[model samples]
Target: MSDHPILFLPGPTEVDAELREIMARPLIGHRSAGFVDDVQQVCQRLKWLYQTSQHAVFESAPATALMEAAFRNLVRPGGRTLHLVCGAFSERWSKIATDCGRKPELLTVPWGMAHDAASLRQKLASSPTFEAVCITHNETSTGVIEPLQELAAVVRDASPSTLILADVVTSLAGAPLNFDAFGLDLAFAGTQKCLALPPGIATYALSHRALERARSIEGRGYLLDFVRAVPETEAGKTLATPCVPLLWALRAQLDRIATEGLARRFARHIAMQHETLAFMHQWQIEPFVADSAARSPTISCLKASGRDVRQLAENATKAGYKIDQGYGDLKGKTFRIGHMGDHTVARLQKMLAALLR
Candidate 1:
């Protein structure tokens, strides 16, 4: 209606106008007391969003930087890690571990498939004991959603000490991820997706056990180290310069999130997913993830069916809809529909209508 193409890519999703205005506010000194208060409040809201009573981490970098932080802190050098790979993003976790000098064994499932707790338990039973188990809560590349609570339960039962580090980049705030309830050691997210903010700021949560592990682990480095971040955070200070404007925007966004309530927010994402799926079904297009239980509520990766997906994407773009053209090897074979951030069911319906035309 505004003559602007609606964004339906995974992330960074469209930011609300209010958030954009907030971001445009005048910059402030990161070391000022006011900035410190802003960061502290942002961390508290992040903890509530993560549903964790542990350390709420703040990094002036993107979520990719924190991925390195998670591996460095939780897995120590040469530590064995069990990586559950289902899609492009999840697969990157293993590479990160390898690059970080950790021994990572991957239990790879085909794209569009999910790993349940029982399956993970079986995998762990046969595999060597791992210091950390890494997983992606939502696989944006394939639109597959792994059941983290169930998987964490299996880890807890099989290897109680094994740290669970979840890549929640695409799932956080879009879905309900109770970090403490799921017994996860650490989980982190970028603000661009579900948080509906611009990129460049990442929030992370680490459990008490994870902090202890980080303290004992060496070669963790300076910039992304959790050990240094925790004490500074506890003291209401930052270890380095932070993105103050983004923090301001994040605080404003968090307030809106609180007003909407996480439950309602999750329901909004679910409704959008169903609406898109219903449209996809009526159109007779195949879903990338055949299993409904494994489908991501935030991002829907649909099979291109026989249509030229590249042309379809071009058509959609010309028609004022910014949809996806898939990712990696699946590019041009699948198309994704992102339903997260500050988006609503009504907005998606309007966009779908434009694409259908």
Candidate 2:
């Protein structure tokens, strides 16, 4: 086994050695013709990975930037948006919408519970003014996985005008997200999570409708405006200079993911999640997300129960395995274990053994 300590924490999770090497490649000019070709290839691969033929842009910032971009570009001033709030990140989406001067109605559930599609349907039915709906496909804070397809269907049936914007920061690469098939207006994820790449870059896919929305709106922020990004993306470049090293790392990681194949990769994640949940059961600990259906396959949020989760995490870290101590409102009450990003079954078993010991 490698002597290096492994990362089981969500986001900035374990970076594969090959990907690390890719990032170490000498930096290239962001605007060079060769670099443009590189960026175009990366974008194409991203679209393939996202299961969408639509445009996929690589952002220099993390997923948060893309979140803000969604609001600024898609939701016009005075436009109404329905934010499905179930955890810290989901709430942040709502906050971003409001910050963009849009009136956003929040469909909230407790941190540990999944947001219900039926409730969202009712909300949309009653509120005809909503122009878009924002949802987190996987909530990292509470380890809850919202039913994206069901929720998308609900929104489509209730409000055809409502564009569906999804955050898949934690779910992408670990699970299957058919962006085109689901008809999502926009979706984005960071490279640090399931992509097993280093931080500093995010990948997002945009539908034709999303582009139209952006074109209709004026004075959207220059950096994140889809109208600006789309043309530059078609030209095989970015609006501004990008983190070239991170882009190389992303390409490497996507290549690895492709080699593994999506079906096998998703199944591997599911198996690891099940293994972690089984261990949690043995310890008499419950998952933060109570409904198994709502639990994320990439990361498992385990309730700390009577134990000090912080201390437990500290102890685990000292043993060379790092884990997450939850986030936001459930910080102390829960802990998260990431099973994504090149983490193998043997590695997970070893970590579980160390924790149980």
Question: What C-alpha lDDT, on a 0 to 100 scale, does residue 132 get in candidate 1?
Answer: 92
Give Cα-based local distance difference scores for all models.
0.88, 0.87
**Alpha carbon deviation, residue 17, candidate 2 (Å):** 1.0
Where model 2 places Cα greater than 4 Å from the true spot, the runs are: 1-3
TM-score attained by model 1:
0.97
Q: Candidate 1, which segments miss by more than 4 Å at Cα? A: none
Tell me the deviation in Å of residue 291 in model 2: 1.0
Q: Tens-digit lDDT track for model 2 on 1-357?
A: 457778999878998787778878888898898889888889889889889988887778888998888878988888888889998899988888878788888889988888777788788877776888898999888888999988999988888888999999999999889999888999999988998877788889999888998888867888788898877976777998889888877777778889999999999999999999998899898887778899999999998888789888987777798898878777888889999989998889988887866
lDDT of 2: 0.87
Residue 300 displacement in candidate 2 (angstroms): 0.7
Question: In model 2, which range of ten residues has the least summed lDDT?
Answer: 121-130
